[model samples]
Target: MAATPALEIAPEKVAHVIIKAREYGAKVGAWNASTEEGDADEDPSAILEDFASDPTLGEIAGFIDALNDDEQANLVALAWIGRGTFEPEEFDEAVDTARSEQGNSTASYLLGLPLLSDYLEEGLEKLGFSANDVESDVL
Candidate 1:
């Protein structure tokens, strides 16, 4: 079997990102957009509504932005690996590509992926890390 790839980004950090990403991904776009306001008891679905000004988005983005450049690159590479763009053995290549191909903000680029949480989790698993275990610890 191929050797497990090492990760520059800590599993704990990645787990944190996964948790936040899951929260962000669970949001629905303005499901309660109608001006009709209702009591929480009447419309609990409001909690799932995602407004353009939602802080969750900013929170996750800021968390990702705080990481150094190498961490950001490794993050992108991990996502790529999870998404099947590269094999686990190609980790270094993936990281190198991530660095060279960086254009927009890493946070922006990553946040744009609807399946960011899944991809990251899968990437961690592929690298022989247990995302679930790390995530539980993070929580």
Candidate 2:
């Protein structure tokens, strides 16, 4: 079947989000990979402290929080599309639902979802957009 038309949010805007989600995913992975044990010279609590204080995590959250309502809704819709909650043909309906359901705190909501980066990337693919350029640009 032919791919769905472009998103109201624009591929570039979605790509911007894809980049941030990727960075956020990497940080989360690193934090999870780190050992719980502390070095002889360091306090054990410091590990958790550093994880909590990670600037990259904060940047990701801040960037999402900075998005306007429409942008945030678009992100949610894209994720839903990627995650199979909606098909590509249902894109407009998905976006409409996202806008009505999102209310406030979209950043927190989106960040709370696991595999967010994967979902966003898949969503773009559903719309016939490749994430290769976005990934390269983010690197």
Candidate 3:
């Protein structure tokens, strides 16, 4: 006999997860810098790079990277919505709070959020999760 499986969740669901995670991170002040208003013409990657370089922020990014594909998606959303500077001390506290409240890392929390299928699919693939696996509970 064949085994039945849980239906794969939708890609939008995955995107939603990312959104939630970002918002949570933002509210907790998980920003990449100390200020929001920059040169206005500065490159975004530079900011991310800066964040990646900071000891605390870099640790956070590593944490973000550790999240499952679903978490990765939401981290993107969080970044989209919560762009700008963040106080590391405050952000650290928030990360702790987010963890207690969300029951997962900020990134993983967002992965369960809703988002466009195409984006979610691509995100999952990037995170090393099979898009098909996302469709079901195999993973």
RMSD of each: 1.9, 5.0, 15.1
Top TM-score prediction, candidate number? 1
- Deviation in Å, model 2, residue 87 alpha carbon: 0.3
The TM-score values for the models, in the order shown, are 0.92, 0.74, 0.23
lDDT of 1 by residue, 1-47 (tens): 67866788888999999999999999887755674443457678877
For 40-106, candidate 2 gives per-residue lDDT tens digits of 3654433333355466567777877877777778889999999999999988789889988876688
Best of the two (1, 3) by lDDT: 1
**Model 3, position 138: C-alpha lDDT score:** 27
Q: Whole-model lDDT, candidate 1?
A: 0.89
- In model 2, which regions exceed 4 Å deviation? 1-3, 28-50
Model number with the top lDDT: 1
Cα displacement (angstroms), candidate 1, residue 87, comes to 0.2
Q: What is the C-alpha lDDT of each candidate?
A: 0.89, 0.73, 0.41
Q: Regarding TM-score, does 1 or 2 come out ahead?
A: 1
Candidate 1 residue spans exceeding 4 A from truth: 34-41
